[model samples]
Target chain A: MSSALVYALTGAALFVLGMAGLILQPHLLRKILAFNIMGSGIFLMLVGVAQRAGTPDPVPQAMVLTGIVVAIAATALALALARQLLDMNGEMRLPEEKTGKDRLDV
Target chain B: MRTLLNVTVLFLASAFGLALGWLILDLPVAAVRLPEQVTAQLEMSGVVHPVTAVLLNFRGYDTLLEIAVLLLALLGILALPRHVSDHQHRPSSANPVLQTLTRVLAPLMLLVAGYVLWAGAHRPGGAFQAGAVLAGAGVLLHLAGLLPAWATPGRTLRAGLAVGLLVFIAVAVALMAQGTLLQYPLSWAGALILMIEASLTLSLGLILAGLYLVLTDSGVQK
Candidate 1:
């Protein structure tokens, strides 16, 4: 009903979307993008929920700022790892897992 | 089978989203009023801007560790095995217009970064924003072929990269002599925050720019 609630709901949807992409996307870069999207969703939820009373809250905003920096650092590290994989294997996707009965150890 | 998995995942995701949305809607009003507390202590926190005060003062520890994390990421990238690509080594031949534009814009960007860093004390700007601007300038310079991709960081560059964190730790340690970690005396809070922010701006700029620089093909070349 409120603007803050709207933002929070949108963030929840983004988190779900990102989670799905993280599971289904084979490309490491895409997975990283998904991870970032998930992080953004969390940040949005954090600030939005904290400000649900419509008052500006500095703590969550500051936390989100810190989160943004950390997210970028994590993303950079992930990208570097992915780039190394691409250099070595000539592709960015991980080897597909054997599914169904073949995936079962027994 | 794949279709079944997709259907299950889609169904689960939607369910999760609905639950989360419902939970948000149901959340009771928070008992703690952090904004009021921040406002009450804003003068003591050493900055006019509440977010800036919270970042560099109330929750300074997070920012301190954040800089370290950024430096560590750069280190990880640097430690990756070197792969010299001949094509990467070839000098970038940028468009003359872009080059000219970069030459004109880089100085202005530096000025803006400085302004943003100084403005953080009273406004929305802060070290992170300022450093990001600086990093943007570096990326632009590289794109224009005005700056070379970093190979192994030399001694000076390494020092510059570590200086912000070092300064922050030093300040924390210095403050510890008087009280607990990072507890600045009321008199020195403003100056101390500014001093720390100035160094952080430089180091954050270097570290953030290094994130992009070291990942480039030319940077990977030994």
Candidate 2:
């Protein structure tokens, strides 16, 4: 297999891992981290799949650069919201997910 | 029940992974050869680097919208209600070693950011990367207590935050008088792109750093 294909496969695995983490973990911070991981996986997949034919494609590379910037902005926004929640409620968790001992799972 | 839910989700996620991997493996060679096309139009696109050309010329609208999105994110953070206990206080100065390191390193980082911004025309650097570096320097200064967490930004700071998008939109609207939106004339493309990138670098730096600074002073952490 080509190196790009390997990267793509790893990205797939990472996406799944991130998805699992996003679902299973109750902490807002961990959820944010998982969301970032999922974004990275998507970025990797995009570039890897595009370059899988052995030629560097500037289009996908540029897109990935754009994606990175957007991801960071999204992350920052999420963190701000989480921080706001923490300030108001004294915890960084969704109201729905706060069920007993697992609420303090972090 | 939580364990059962977790197990089921894990199993489904694993299955999804397998499917995604299979789909990736099955992806046929792309019919369109974008690199060749990008190379062919490289001269007209104004920048020697293909990625920069695509980012600021061919796909300039995307970058324009991206700056808007970034600004919106900062605005969203600013819109959040301020905690009453959150005061305009500076973090205590860190260890002398860290402070000294920040003093030495911040200027160097700014220099690097400038170089990167200039180099995007022909190399693997650009406004986004440069802006990120600039923000990193700001974070470092804040961490070392050379800079304080932001309260409300002042007029000059606010103007700086908006300048990039303003310049970008002005350019786009000006170009629209001649033809379609963001379609730069071949003769003016390089200079226009550089101007835009410079403004973008400044604004992006502020916005990115604001994302951090606006949160730190919130007294959120336990």
Best by DockQ: 2
Pairs of residues clashing in candidate 2: none
lDDT of 1: 0.88
lDDT of 1 by residue, A17-90 (tens): 99987876666888999999999999999989998898879999999998998899899999988878878887
Clashing pairs in 1: none
Model 1 Cα lDDT, one tens digit per residue, B165-203: 999999998888876878778998999999999999999
What are the C-alpha RMSDs, in order, of all predicted structures? Answer: 3.4, 2.4
Candidate 1 residue runs with Cα over 4 Å from true position: A96-106, B85-92, B220-222
Per-residue lDDT of model 2, residues B1-222, tens digit only: 788778899999999999999999999888889999999999998899999999999999999999999999999988887655646455667579999999999999999999999999999999999999999999888888888776788799999999999999999999998878899999999999999999999999999999888777643333
Overall local distance difference test of candidate 2 = 0.90
In model 2 chain A, where is the ten-residue run with the lowest total lDDT?
A: A97-106
Model 2: CA > 4 A from native: A100-104, B84-94, B218-222
Docking class of 1: medium
DockQ of each: 0.56, 0.79
Per-residue lDDT, model 2, residue A64, is 91
